[model samples]
Target: MDFDPRLTPARSDLAARRLQARVTAERFVDGTPARVVVGLAPLRRGPRGDARLDTEALAGESLTVYDEDEEGWGWVQLDRDGYVGYLPTHAYMKGDVARPTHRVTALRTFVYPALSIKEPPLDWLTLGARIAGIAERVVDGRAYVITASGGVVVADHLAPLDRVEADPVVVAERFLGTPYLWGGRSSLGIDCSGLVQTALEACGVAAPRDTDLQEAALGTPVDLDPAQWRRGDLLFWPGHVGLVRDATTFLHANAHVMAVSIEPIAAGLARIAAAGAPLRSVRRVERPQ
Candidate 1:
């Protein structure tokens, strides 16, 4: 197909209007294959393979999804930064709903600015990159966000959604089997507090960084044996913290073996005991009334 530079200005205008329309309606085209680029400048020689998506790509603002056939694939355009590319038909959905979506798809954006990208998918572009975006809704205990450029970002990398009230255990489940990384905080990779923080934030709850900060933020420590702990309860160690999903299971991105995984509380505690380590503490983030 012949390229059209003349459409650039009109496309830019349409892009701007589209963004405003989505924001105003609080909706976006869902369930479609759209490619939103993550870069600063537009493609000079037209679209091709091996193009890179940089950190400042799309300036962390906008991206475009072009249609492949007649529209030449979903033309994804960013607002401040210019990132254009061709995405597969399976990349997106079509619709204008703001319902919560799972990061069943993988990418590098999250809700909070400080959260880290831990272990992203290898085949997926922009894997292991720290990204920032805002989560729109909470569904099934998970916070779904629209990527900075565009598209929905769910539990893959994450952001705390609401602080009002939440199911911490359910939120924690979003990270099941995630690999542990030091100072990491995304579905790509994550640490103890990163897991807790992301999970809590996704559910609209707030928590501090590190075990100490989280410890200080919670209300008076709940005094109960590990067996009595329930979902949403914070499980801590000297240098670790996690959210209990049940009496026997808790979730965390642990340094013990590194990576997010769920295990029986007794086994986890027993492992710590066997290693001659102390079981840190169990604190619960006060639920909003």
Candidate 2:
């Protein structure tokens, strides 16, 4: 099968072998499927700790492992976004687990041993992470969702697997002030495209991981006229993107401020232009009226 070397984790293997094949195909070398075990595992460009972080894998996310180096790093592709990178082999567990029945909607939530909030947390879940076996239990008049893993999470922080938010911008706004982090997808930190992707995905809208790919594939193109811009519209630059908070404001997880922030569109436009990356295009994602 044909694939872009830059995006494929197994590019080196492809060069060594004349034919290309899917990871699931038997002809593919050292191919195995695994699931991420940590809450968030950094996917790096290289096997070393000093390697540049390229992306991240949320807990229970599937990974297609292509190879493992002597240093214990596995070259893999993240199934959620198809991002390729290296991570420690121990971070993954072989095979998939049961599909999640609910998704964590809060910035972060704790998994407790019982319904009581006083108990020490057994684990922590980030926004967009999925969990299975939801059983509602009331504790001191507050409802909690019990997980199959024998943990309790705040009910308000979870949404049924079938439910999705109506407005992506509203979801994005919930992350205002989140720390900026390159290749991060969780609320602990996030990047420009990560914010957009997470917000859109929470609303049942699919999006890619990087600005360039997102600029090419997401939403219908619109003229750069400010009057035409609406809430939920996406603004793009060479390596950056932001969501329209309204007709006059732009919201983004920006490195300039090192946090998610909202600024006047005119000022944001000038700021990006001054940096030599002029606004490239505007793309509008329709929301229910």
Candidate 3:
């Protein structure tokens, strides 16, 4: 079988560079698809009696772009989490447009301009709102974000973007007290790697999803003691990740705490070291200014 596009050389240095350039803050409007097509309403199918999109496309596919009529009604291909199918253009909006843009956290903010104020994922906040104040990796890809106001939103969810170097520990600290959520990747609720990824993104750095993907993306491992570590240094063990806040402390989201929190890095390492887990690996990702 072919390699996963995310795993292959599809995202080259040139592409990575371009991603760094074009990623702006934005949202997705019309081009969305059901995570699964449960069933179809008549309007979802073409009026001229075209085949239903759900009947044709499989899960995790992409759709084509279509033209809209003067009345603002048209057929467009809908891509949902990689699944592409046909849907009405009217269902989307420029105000709701979702494309990839590289930007930092604007505020300790919330998603706005939404259908509802409560826990909505498609809601968005003002662009360029706050200074995320962290360092991210230097690579490129679209990011789905959550606003502090408990709203979900995807900014430039499809475009690629790159981040330059910044400190991971400083980045992690910004999200301190952020609640933990499974499969979450934003300031609202985040996982360990999600915490890492978002922290890096805020600092204009890039990292992969999950601990394993992130570990591989770091290129190679480095061995060093706490005294030798710096702000952006990353710490990892089996099934967990933490960012060095300094020589003594680090930040992470843990099920144990069930939210983003800070702790003594040396103490954590001491626990692990005493348990004889041994250090799986360590790496320092720094972006050149």
Task: Give TM per candidate.
Answer: 0.47, 0.89, 0.51
* lDDT of candidate 2 at residue 247, scale 0 to 100: 75
- Candidate 1 C-alpha lDDT tens digits along 1-289: 2332322212332333434433233233422322222322223223333433211221122334533345333444422223334433233434432332232223343333222234342223222222344446565666555454454454544323222225656656666677775545455556787667656644556555456667777645766587566678887677778777776787778777666788788888889778776676777666555
Poorest 10 consecutive residues of model 1 by lDDT? Answer: 53-62
Over 4 Å off, model 3: 1-104, 111-166, 272-278
Pick out the ten consecutive residues of candidate 2 with the lowest summed lDDT.
12-21
Q: Which candidate would rank higher by lDDT, 2 or 3?
A: 2
Clashes of each: 50, 0, 40
Residue-level lDDT of model 3, residues 136-187, one tens digit each, is 2222352344333223334432112344334556656767787886655555
lDDT (10s digit) by residue, model 2, range 84-137: 888888888776555578888988888888878899987787888877755798
Note the Cα lDDT for every prediction shown: 0.49, 0.83, 0.48
**What is candidate 1's CA lDDT for residue 136?**
65
Name the candidate that leads on TM-score. Answer: 2
